[model samples]
Structure formats: C-alpha cells, structure tokens
Target: MRGVEHSIQLVPDYRVHHQAPYRLSILEATELKRHLEELLRLGFIKPSNSPWGAPVLFARKADGTLRLCIDYRGLNRYTVKNSYPMPRADELFDRLEDNRFFTKINLRSGYHQIRVATEDQPKTAFRSRFGHYEFTVMPFGLTNAPATFQTTMNNIFRDILEEYILVYLDDILVYSRTLEDHIRHLRDVLQRLRKHDFYAKLSKCRFAQRKVNFLEHHVSDQGLHMDDAKISAIAECPVPTSAKQLRSFLGLTSYYTNFIQGYARYSYVLTSTLLRKNPPWFWTPLCEDAFRALKKAVTCAPVLRLPDFDCPFIVTTDASDFAVGAVLSQGKGVYQFTNKYGANVDGYSPIYTPDEWSATGDTYAAGTQGLLLWAVTLGALLLGGALLIFNTSALS
Candidate 1:
C-alpha cells in the first residue's frame, strides 16, 4: 500500500555501526520468525545488508502477543531531534468545552502507515537470527516517528483542525456541539483519512458519545475530571519501605498535583526523606501522616469545571508556620498550591512572617481583581527567601 514518505535527519558527522543481535529465548525466536514472515509478506520490510543494524526487542501486548521492536536507542543518539510542535493537552481539552458529541479514532499501526525515505531506510535496519531486515515503512521507537506522523496528520486535516477535529499523534478527536454536526465532522475526518490511505482501527474507535477519556482526563459537557483508575491506583498504593519506593510513590501522586490541595505540604515529609544522604530508609510518623493525607485527598479530588473566560477569578491564600497555600477559583471550581513544610534556611524560626503574608495577599488580590494575575510569586522566608512560582491558569 502507498504510505506517507518520511525522512530521518541526522546531525552532522554522526554515524552509527551495526549492533549484534540480542540472544532470544525459544519462544522469542519463534515469535520473531512469525513477525518477520508477516512483515515480509506485507512488504513492510525486506532483506537488507546494511552497514548499520540494531538488536531486536520484544514487548508483550495486552493480548499476550509479543510485538517485535528494534532497539533504536543507539541510533537515536546520533539523530537530530525534530522540532515540530505538538498540541498542548490543556489546549486540546479546552476545545472540547461545549462539545457534546465526540468520536475518538485510533489509527491502525500509525507509524507503519508511513514509509521511510529510501536513503534513510538503511539506518533503520535491524538484525535477527534469520537475517537482517530494513523497514520500508516507518517503525515504532524511532526518534522522529512521532513528529513525522504528527506532521502528516496536521497537513491532512489542516482545514478542520481546532474546529471540528483535534489530532494528537495517532488519536483523532472529532467533536461538535450538536449530534448532526458531529456526524458531519466525523464523516469529513474519515473521508480525509481515506483520501490519504490512512485507516483507523474500528474496534478501538469510540463513536458519537457524550463522554470520552482523552489524554488521561475524562472529558465531557460536564467538564474535565481526573480518571478514576488513576485515582484508585494512588489511593491503593502501599507505604514505601525504601527511598526508591517513596520516590516512585511521590512521582505517581505528583502527576495529579493540580487536583490535590496543598500537594507540596502533603508530600513534604516523604520528599525530605529523599533529600537526605548517607541515611537508612525509615518511615517516620510524619511520613505516615503525609502518605495517608495524600491518599485521602486524591480519593476526594474535586471535579474541575471548564474555565469561563468571561467571569472574574477569585484568588485566596493562607500562610502557616509550616507552609503557605493558595487557591484560585472561578465559579465553584478551585485549584490549589502550597509550599514545602518546615522549609527553612539558616534554621529560620517562622516560615512566613505576618508582614510577608500581608504583602503576598495584597499582590494576589490586586492581580486577580485586575484580571492580570498571570503569575504569583510567593517567597519562602525560611528557605533564605526562595521563591515559589505558580501560574494562575495552571491551577484551572
């Protein structure tokens, strides 16, 4: 089948050599052979005698099938990164505000639908026990593959982007304010994809629906909500026994930092454990308190409402001896932020002095009332006057 032509660009004076084939188990060997046979039959790849080769790796899919993948990490190091911009998740979510009807399309093996430029195909060659093969079509795990696919999608749907269509990599979201309009939008997107010979997996596609999960957030006419699965994972996480485990827990919770009020304060004790050097891992009473507080907070996270640009915002802040926190609200929805607990410099006594609180409150109040509260800077008096920056819109 005809596919979109994509080229891989390398930095000047960078060259890669062949990597020896990785040892595979008997099952892996059988899987690799099956994959090679299928790809050969489909003409997606062919026998190659290229100077550059990479070892193959197998990733198990949800269906218990192994996916053949080439380890391109070494090759990627020599490649120049494509600077093509991708649409921001926030901006994409914002476009679905008033959208009632939605359709999500998942392109089938999206990267494989694009052909590697002739001269660059050799650089993508990989070795297997059977022989060496190079991809005629673009393969997964390539550095520039995402940029190439995004560029193709953008070009294909240039006229409808941000209107009735939102394309992010291989996921295509077709949204409209009305059912009739939504159908038309979906038709237009499918027709465009057909024209370019791009195919979407029907099973994975969600037809006109009132609600859909996109970019890890549940989006609908009601507004954006944190995914329940993610929240459940956080709530069910066990107490960390080691610093590494604590770091992993922190990383997971930090993802929903915007959803949690005083996230920094809640995580302060656990974070401090990570900062300590040459010490045994110990879960203190403070750490235990923080962990439980975080779990409770995530389970009760507020459902955020879509921002209304027409309305004025309300900004509120509170400071304590341990930490400083702030909340930005519009309508009934609010986003919160806070500083670390016991964050002091030179062993300072107070975290935030009364005068500092007043000054900070005045700044926030003035900025919000004037609709110029683009950014807020809170000084940590204890940490030798370290500044904590918060973007007003980020909370929303």
Candidate 2:
C-alpha cells in the first residue's frame, strides 16, 4: 500500500443508514462464506461493531461464480463527491498514433490495493448473514472510489503519463516507437510499480503487442477502430417494445457518437419519440430506418486517421432541413480526433430553411462555426463549402 490512502468526507448532517442483508441461495451462501474467509485471511476485511451498516449481495461473474458486492447506495448518498478528471479517450489515442509497440497492464484488484484511511474504515462497514464486517482497503461501490483511485494512479505515473504511458484507474498502457525503446519503457514502468508495492495480474497483461484494446478502444500504428466484440449489440439489437429498451439502445450507441457524422440527425427520430410526450410506444417507419442506419453506420465507422500537420485539411459540410453537418479530412482520407470535432445538430438557428441555406447571407455564420472548430485543433483548415479549386497538374 502507498503512503496515501482514500478518505471518505461525509456531509456533516448525514444520517446513519443501516440495511439488512438479503437472503441468498445455497450456492451464493457457499460463495459468500469462501469470499469472507479469503478476505479475512488477506487482512482486507474484518468483523466490525459499528452503527453504519450496508448490506452485501452476490452478483454472478462471467466464469459462473458469485462476486460478493456491498449495497453502499445508502452510505454513498451522504458522502462528498469527488470530481477528479480521468484522461480523455481522444487525447490518449492521439499519443498512440505514432507508436509501433504497446503493453497493457491490468492491476490486480486495483481498488483493494489502496488502503482506506484509519478513521474512515468503520464507514465502509457492510452486513452479512455471518456477521458485520468492514473493509480495511478501499472497496467498490463507494461514490468517490473511482476518483480517489484515479488520483492515486495519476500521481504514481504522472511523470511518464502521456509521454509513453497512460493510466485509467487500474488499466495501464505503455506505447513505444521501436522494440528496443519498448523494452526500456516496459522496464521503467515495472520498476515504478515494484517500488510502489503494486502488483499486476499476469494472465491479463499484454506485453509488446502490435495492437491492443484499452478503454473500449482498439489502438495501433494504422489508426483507430472500434472493437467488434464491444459493438456486437448494435448488430443484434431488436426493435424496442418499451421506452426502457429504446433508452438502452441509445445509451449503448452514445459512446461512439463521435465516430459517426451527423449522428444526432440520424438518431433524432428515436430520441424525439423517447423525450417528447408521445402516444403509445409504437415502432414507426422513420424510427426503424433511423435504428437500422445508426447500427450500420456505427458498425462500419471509417477508421479515424492520425492528424498530418504537413498537409492541408478539408472540412466538408452540408445543410439539411433540420441539421447542418461537417467532416474534417486530410489529403484524401479523413485523419483527425474528436476533441475539437464540431457537429452542429439542431444547433443552427432556424432562420434559414434548407433551400435558402446556399443563397442566404446567414450561411457565413454557420460556415465560420465549422471552420473555427477544426481550426482550433490544427493550425491550418480549409473550409470546403460547396466548391473545390485545386491545381490541375496534380490531377493530370
């Protein structure tokens, strides 16, 4: 454990909430007993005598085993929120574009590696059929656990972070341009982990890989591509019979909103149906088209290319009856990230209709917005409106 520990800062007027443990079946009870014994043996948890009591339950793991989870919702309600920022996916990917070798390390029981502050241990108490117990180390389900863990990881890897290494909570990714450099970089990272008394799960770590998946993204020298396994739901998703199902589908696709151009325009029908006061839940023709189009577009999203500062960029744009769209491209193919990505969906002032968009004076303002968004990221941007004037010698 590091010298720094996770501390819970609860609201002053917080009320103490206690919960009873839910009954489990024979298999779950056996799993819980085994877990409790193991945790006790490792000095992670111990029998407690405290007024603050949360209940524990079992969630089935992918390997068909029960994972003991504590219902800390009551306790989380009164805890002060942590706002530590995690690394941006776009920025992280931008750094890996030039690297050839990659190593990803998965910390073993990341949260449990951090010790909870001594005075805050009782606050982590949870109830069980066997007895009341509390965590000595940081436990999952705490409101601020992610932020706390992120802060610790950031501090540990701050010097090398974004240079050739990146950490998001427990996942560590190290990137290098050459095999020789990768070895040196990997050694440095391992040494730091060793000095800090951290451990990695060998089964989960990938060393000197040409490509690896980190934070739901596939990375390599070529460009960015969405993981096929992660997006399988988009292909197999069924028509929604209820609002909940529709919401679930949208939530799933929302993560890759940046990958698809004019996503809001394409998915507007379903969103409007969900958000607006509506009649009975019915699958309209437009809703079906929107759902199918989104699934296809997201699944076939063009591989995002690394920015080429050596050449000029093209910003292709179009205006529809309801939305105005823009695409940032370089050379022949689009090569860019989304940190400065600008897509105006339901954003253009409705003063000009689709027919007047080209002829009207208001087109200047809308066009400038697109140019500025792309320009802010790259020093040079070509606002390719409806025309292109290039040297004829190149085409010949």
Looking at model 1, the pairs that clash are 344-382, 345-382
Model 2 global lDDT (CA atoms, 0 to 1): 0.73
Give one digit per residue, the lDDT tens place, for model 1 in 1-396. Answer: 265688878889887768889999999999999989999999999999899899998998746888888999988999999989988776676567567888889999898898999999999999988999999999998888898889999999998898989899999889899999988888898888898899999998899998887777777877777888788878889888888787788888776665676676677656655547856877778879989998998897766555444544334444433334554344433333232233222211111111112232243444332222322332221112322322232121
Best by TM-score: 2
TM-score of each: 0.78, 0.81
Tens-digit per-residue lDDT, 1-396, candidate 2? 488798999999999889988888888888888999999999999899989999889887646777889999999999999888877766666567568999999999999999999999999999988999999999999999999888888888888988989998899999999999999999999999998999999999999999888888777776667777657867889988888888888888877765675576766677765655665787888988988998887776756665444445444445444444444455533333231134332211110011111222333334445434433323222222323222111110
What lDDT is reached at residue 291 by model 1? 90
Sequence-dependent TM-score of model 1: 0.78
lDDT of each: 0.72, 0.73
* Candidate 2 error regions (>4 Å): 23-30, 58-67, 277-279, 332-396
